[model samples]
Target: MAGLFGSATLGIGGGTLSDLFRAQYRGKAVAIYSWSPILAPLVGAVLGGFISQNTTWRWTFYASSLLSIVIQLSGLIFLEVTYPPLLLRRKKARQAKATGADDLYTEYDHLDEGRVQVLSTNLFRPFKLLATQPIIQILALYNAYFYGNIYILYANYIDLWTNVYGEFIEIAGLNYIAIAIGSSIAAECCTLINYAIFRKLSSRNGGTGVPEFRVPIMLPATLFFK
Candidate 1:
């Protein structure tokens, strides 16, 4: 339960940071952030093996805790809210100072409904939409299948490396680097192709791009995943 909570918190915080970055910088941020899940476990297992060999297994938890503390301190010193509503509030204040308006405020400061009711509606709407929306249902089903395949691959990969290839722990860990590299290359290629397609479609459509123009790119990705 504690580990699950920590993972959720990290995911939320990382998402918040990504939202703070501009669109131009977001691709690089997301790429680096996505790399952590693949790299961390492999690096952790290598370190854990060495640590347990030399000292004790308990030190692993202690080392992780210390690292978390350092990260927390750094965040406290540097991190700030990047949500548009909050930034708009600050911007409004500055504009008020420059123009000396007494009634300066952002749209976020005014709510037509109560906050508690809004929160409750927002939380439940996703469930309602998922229940009724065909597109959402189909996508959810597809995502479940994709995740299941990934988990199965993760579970069986070690056996394939150790038994089939006769590799040791470090060598098996190195195999994951190939998966990471392949994924990175695939993502880069897809991004470039997407940009090209978007450009061509925009030119064809009188320099205007529509969301439907992007749907064709998903076909290739779906085929690759299959």
Candidate 2:
């Protein structure tokens, strides 16, 4: 999970969006990317409920494991490196290989920045940030609560519907329809409203943007969060 869609993918996606798109297109790109995390689990829960009901409950883990393996394998086969530092290092490597001299280097690959140093930095940076940055700590805590409740809800959702409502397992998955609809609407609102608010704020501030402009968008999110 960490290697695939957890912190690693979140970090990569944020960087990849900045690297791949201009500022004008970044918000829209980010909207789609951000919406994906919600969509995946909602879809997964519906499918998993049906799978568990007809087959053994253990099949849920097997199915998810298989899907994860397929996603990872596909990434290995088809994912392109969008990170500029990594891409630059690859180009430098190819050039050094062509010539006899193997002394090619970039600022990111300096003599002081060995593989061990880079690996350690990446491994511990999140923890360091979480400890040192108040904003990061708050965000981490909020997300812990947010996603923790969400996963717990999804985990118990099927049992709740089947037992309390006395619904058949096959149709119990249908209960998620309202959640799925609401989430879809929220995703669309995020894309449209965020972009509109940003543009409006930028215009109001003598054609410049302020971090304060982003705060209003968070107001709605915070109100709806719990």
Candidate 3:
């Protein structure tokens, strides 16, 4: 149940991040965010193995708890709301105070009624999109398959390393380095390709890039993932 709750929380976190971050920054941010999901188990295994070998298995839980506390403290200190609507609300309140005018305007203030309707629509929009939108349905199916393959690979990685390669626990954990290496290489390649493509498309489109410019890059990425 705890694991289920944690997964649910993570899904919410990812969705919130996607909602908050602009498309320009989201790719890099998501790539970095994704490293935690990939690295956590490998790090835990390494720490557990060291603790169990040097002292006791119980120390691993203590160490992880301490690290979690430190991370939570850091988040409390540094993280701030970056949503445009929230930021604009804060700005408007400050402006209203300074000018003594209650009629301060913000994009969010105009949407109070519409926002409620939009929220209601969003709640059921995913199912509607899947039923009506071919692009949405296809992309959803592709992403599901990709994520399923990734999970299967993760689940079998240790077996592949230990049984096939004859690695010890620590050595098996070290094999996660291959995942890190592949991720790093892919990141660099994608960054270069995306920048080049964006520049070309922007120039061709009279110096402005649209979301459509991103579509061409997705084909290669999908092919690579497959």
Instruction: Give each model's clash number.
Output: 0, 0, 0
Model 2: lDDT of residue 141: 88
Model number with the top lDDT = 2
- Model 3 spans with C-alpha error above 4 angstroms: 1-70, 113-122
lDDT of 3: 0.72
Give the Å shift of residue 112 in candidate 1.
7.5
Q: Tens digits of per-residue lDDT for model 3 on 1-226?
A: 6365457546766776777776555556665666666667656665665676577778877888788789779978997766677778889889989999997788677655577798888778877989999999888898789878976876677777678888775667667677766866676667567757766887898877786776788887888787
What CA RMSD would you report for each candidate? Answer: 4.3, 3.1, 4.4
Residues 1-226 of candidate 1 have per-residue lDDT tens digits of 6465566656575768557775334445555556565556555655654565567879878887888799789978997877677688789889999999979877888644577998899779878999999999988898789868865876567678778888764567557666667766776666666657766787899877775665678887889888
Q: Give the Cα lDDT of each candidate.
A: 0.70, 0.79, 0.72
Question: What TM-score does prediction 2 earn?
Answer: 0.83
Give the CA lDDT, 0 to 100, for residue 77 in model 1: 95
For candidate 1, what is the TM-score? Answer: 0.69
Residue 170 of model 2 has an lDDT of 65
Across 45-142, the per-residue lDDT of candidate 2 in tens digits comes to 78877898899999988998898899899999998888778788888988888996777788876544678988999889988999999999987888
Candidate 2 to native Cα RMSD, angstroms:
3.1
